[model samples]
Target: MNHLKKCLASLALSLGLAVSSAAAQEAQKIKMGVMQWETIAMTSSVTEHLLERHGFEVEEVEFQEWGVAFAALGKGDVDVLISHPDYAAADYWERNARKLEKLSVASYGYNAGLIVPSYVTINSIDELNEHKEKFRGRIIGVEPGSGMMRQSENVVNEYGLEYEIIEGSGPVAVAELKSALDRGEWIVSMYWTPSWVFQEFDIKFLKDPKGVQEPTETYVWLAHKGFAVQNPKAREVIASVFVPESALTQMTGWVKEGASIDEAVARWEKANANRLDRQAMIGNQ
Candidate 1:
């Protein structure tokens, strides 16, 4: 009986140690939510590298929809995510605001609206109708349910512009823009900045005078509530990360030209070692 009691006690102790070890390991791991968009992917990659360098294991959780991504972060499925909370993902952010925490601005100068090649003479959304014939009374738009598309709908109604927003995927819109530019045809498309297109083509966003759309926004870092309390060091590292719009544009351009996202981010990191070091210092503190 004494032997059996001793053995049972030993088994209980081992189980307790295993559970504690697992918890410790989990604490060192961070799950980051990533979207299919290149900008998000690039920024997420940078954050992942930074966290891993500082001794934390990073796992990227892929999400297709903004609402779903925000939901995941709120539910603790992901520790962190990069998004344009003030504009593009505002609705989602509001819905999950209570369960999430805004960490820092990941990047700035994120703008979305009707864009035209620099060669096009018109410079504002209101002017598009005046040159309807030039633009063929159409606005090339991305996926139908996208935030940008929803905003574009508001833009059309707000401005009372007589134009149709042709709904399609992002790549299709890009292709249409490229084709128009190639043929020297005037075209206006709903597009955004911090994109590879800005680096590759001479395009400009048509000015939104009435401000129906957000003229500029910042991609912010958001995390699950209590993430900071649980992982202060990781939070510091994430908060310290800030990629400029130009850098993100350049990295995205590199990715567009056959470089992998990781390769593009690696190049940026190598060139911006000083910045990375500075961020590391803050994290270490």
Candidate 2:
């Protein structure tokens, strides 16, 4: 009877230790929200690698819509996300501002607006109307719910331009732009910088004289309201990362030329090995 009681006590202690160990592991795990955009993917990949190097596990949660992603972060379903709060995700950020926290600026000088090939004579949004007939009375745009498209709609209404904004996915819009450029036809489409298209084509953003669209934007690292308090170490590592506009554009161009996200990130990591090594050692001390 004494032996049996001792055996039972030992089993209970072991089970308690196992549960505690699992809980500790869970505490060190992070859930990252990822969008479909290439830049977001690249940033997420870089962040994941950095966090892993510092002993944190990262799991990416894919989101198809901006609103959904923001809501998930607010509810704590995701721990972090790379976002453009000032411009691209302004609406979503405003809606969920109370539930999210900005950790750091991931990149700077992200610009978005109407773009035209270099051969086009127009230089500004106001000039777009003058060449409406040449542009076929339409403005090519990306996904319907995207911030760029919403702002593009505002541009149309604000400018009072008589043209239809064609809604489509990013790839479709890019395909349309390429096709128009190949035919040497006049085409104006909503586009943003740090995009691969800039590398592939000689295009420029039309001047936004009325300022309906933000001329310069910043991409930021965002997290759930209490994420910083719960994961200070991870936050420090995240805050330590900052990719310049030129480097981001170069990596994006590489991805556009057939490199996978992993490959692009690997190349970027190799190029900045010394800086990354120091970044990884951020909270270790």
For model 1, the superposed segments whose C-alpha errors exceed 4 Å read 1-26
Query: Which whole-number lDDT from 0 to 100 does residue 242 have in model 2?
Result: 82
> For model 1, how does the per-residue alpha-carbon lDDT over 1-285 read when each residue is reduced to its tens digit?
999999999999999998676546547789999988888888888888889888888888999888788888888888899988876778888898999988888888888888999999888888988999988999999998888898999999999999999999889999999999999999999888888898888999888889899868888889999887667678788888888889989998898889998899999999999889888787565
Model 1: lowest-lDDT 10 consecutive positions: 19-28
lDDT of 2 by residue, 114-144 (tens): 9999999889999877878999999999888
**Number of clashes in every candidate structure?**
0, 0
Report lDDT (Cα) of residue 169, candidate 1: 87
Error of 1 at 279 (Å): 2.0
Q: How far is candidate 1 from the true structure (C-alpha RMSD, Å)?
A: 7.8
**In the order shown, what is each candidate's alpha-carbon RMSD?**
7.8, 8.6
Candidate 1: TM-score? 0.86
